[model samples]
Each structure stands twice: as structure tokens, then as C-alpha cells.
Target: MNKLISVVAVVVGTAAALPASAQITSGSIAQNKAECQAQFRVSDLNGDNFLTPREISLFRGSMPTELSGREVIHRQDFISACYATLPQDD
Candidate 1:
């Protein structure tokens, strides 16, 4: 029907006008290192250079399954694992 066609057109138009969702991708090693360091700094509530299991839980709301049973994690390792767990945009 014409009304149905008009509704479909409007929906399509609105979707086209909206900004695209951000694409998540792995960055270069240097970029990953920097990002990890920044994240570590922000999450390090006690100002220690390392992240304890408790700190990680607080930072991410829950410990990543990949880090389960681990007692401590370095910044670089945490970042790499976290990035690996991210769903690919494609």
C-alpha cells in the first residue's frame, strides 16, 4: 500500500541521516601500549604500577573471562587481552 511504502521510505531516510556507528579496530602496537598505559593509570585506584584482580574487577565491572583465576595482570597484557575480546565491527 502507499501508506506502507511511505513509512518504509521515512524509516530508510532517517536511518541514512543518522551517523554511522563507530568502528572498533585494533591499533598499532605503540597505540595499544599508550592506550593500555592510560587505562591502567585511570584504573589504578591505589596508585600502584600494577593491577590487582580486585582493581581490574572495579575498572571493568567484572573480571574478563580470559583473566579468570589470575591474581595480577600487567598493563600491556590486560590491554591486549581486552582488545582481543572486542567484537570486530565487520
Candidate 2:
């Protein structure tokens, strides 16, 4: 009886923890693309095709650590990074 109870408890605990660790989707590719484009357009103040480090800093409070070494950000690169930072759905 004790062994059966322990098994059931373990199974229940595992099931309960699954949802907590699940990865939430950011959004569809189209949605993310649109959002990223809009963000880039607004941040590209100089009408240049690429974003300077200063522009990026002003747009986002601070650039992500992964982009620390980048001197310039192209449209596609900016979009990809924007998509990556999107909030995950609960």
C-alpha cells in the first residue's frame, strides 16, 4: 500500500511540473516580422538602411549582451533579434 501511494505521488508531481517548464511561443513568423519591421523603422532615425550603435541604444534601453560586439545592425539582423526578445505567452 505504501509503495503504491509513493508511485502515485511521484506521477502526480511530475504531471504538475510539466506546464511550469513548457516553452511558450512568441508569435507567428508573420506577426513577429511585422512587429520587428515597425520597431526598426521607428528606431532608424537617420534614414539610413542600417542602425548605428547609438540609435540601437536609444531605441531599446540597452542592447542585448549577445550583440555587444556589433558595430552596425542591418534590417534583417535587427528583426531577428527583436523577434527573439518578444515576450512568451503565458
Candidate 3:
């Protein structure tokens, strides 16, 4: 009985260690984009193509959330900087 419980606990722990979906397997932009977009869309509280501070806050509030506030802010800052440097969206 003790051995069985230990085995079950290990299995549960290992399963919990896996990601929600195996889709976002790679960190590459192209590969992760679609998955991230899907997640962003579903998670985007304001329905904005871009995430707002509140929306991001809500995202952080939800579940097994990774990435610190600083990380999110830094990522948003970099993205904003890139967009600013872009030629045109039109």
C-alpha cells in the first residue's frame, strides 16, 4: 500500500510538471506565435490585439501563471520599442 501510494504520487507530480499543451514546444517566434496568439486571444480580457495593463494583470492572476510582472513589462516594452522602430503598419 505504501509503495502504491508513492508510485501514484510520483506519477501525478510528473503529469503536473508538463505544460497545458504540447503545442508551444519551441521558443522560436514563428513556431510559438500561433500558440501564443491563441493563448493571447483567449486570455486577452479587453479583446485588443495588443494587451493592456489590466488585461495583462488578469492574465497574471489566472492559474499556474509564470513570468513575473517585471518580465511582462520588459517584454511589452521591447515589443513597443520594436513597433516604434518599424517603418509603418499600413
Q: Which has the greatest TM-score?
A: 2
lDDT of 2 by residue, 1-90 (tens): 996586456434533443432311222122344455655555565657787987665555433345557878887787677677767668
Instruction: Provide TM-scores for the models.
Output: 0.44, 0.47, 0.31
lDDT of 2 at 23: 16
lDDT, model 1, position 24: 17
Error of 1 at 26 (Å): 23
Off by over 4 Å in 3: 1-32, 61-90
Best by lDDT: 2
Better of 1 and 2 by lDDT: 2
What is the TM-score of candidate 3? 0.31
RMSD of each predicted structure: 15.1, 17.9, 11.9
Model 1 lDDT vs. the true structure? Answer: 0.51
lDDT of 2: 0.55
Q: Could you give candidate 1's per-residue lDDT for residues 12-84 as a string of tens digits?
A: 4543443343211123121333444444444554555667876665555423357666778776676676666
**Per-candidate clash tally:** 0, 0, 0
Cα deviation at 21, candidate 3, in Å, is: 6.3
Error of 2 at 89 (Å): 9.2
Better structure of 1 and 2 per TM-score: 2
The CA lDDT at 73 in model 2 is 83
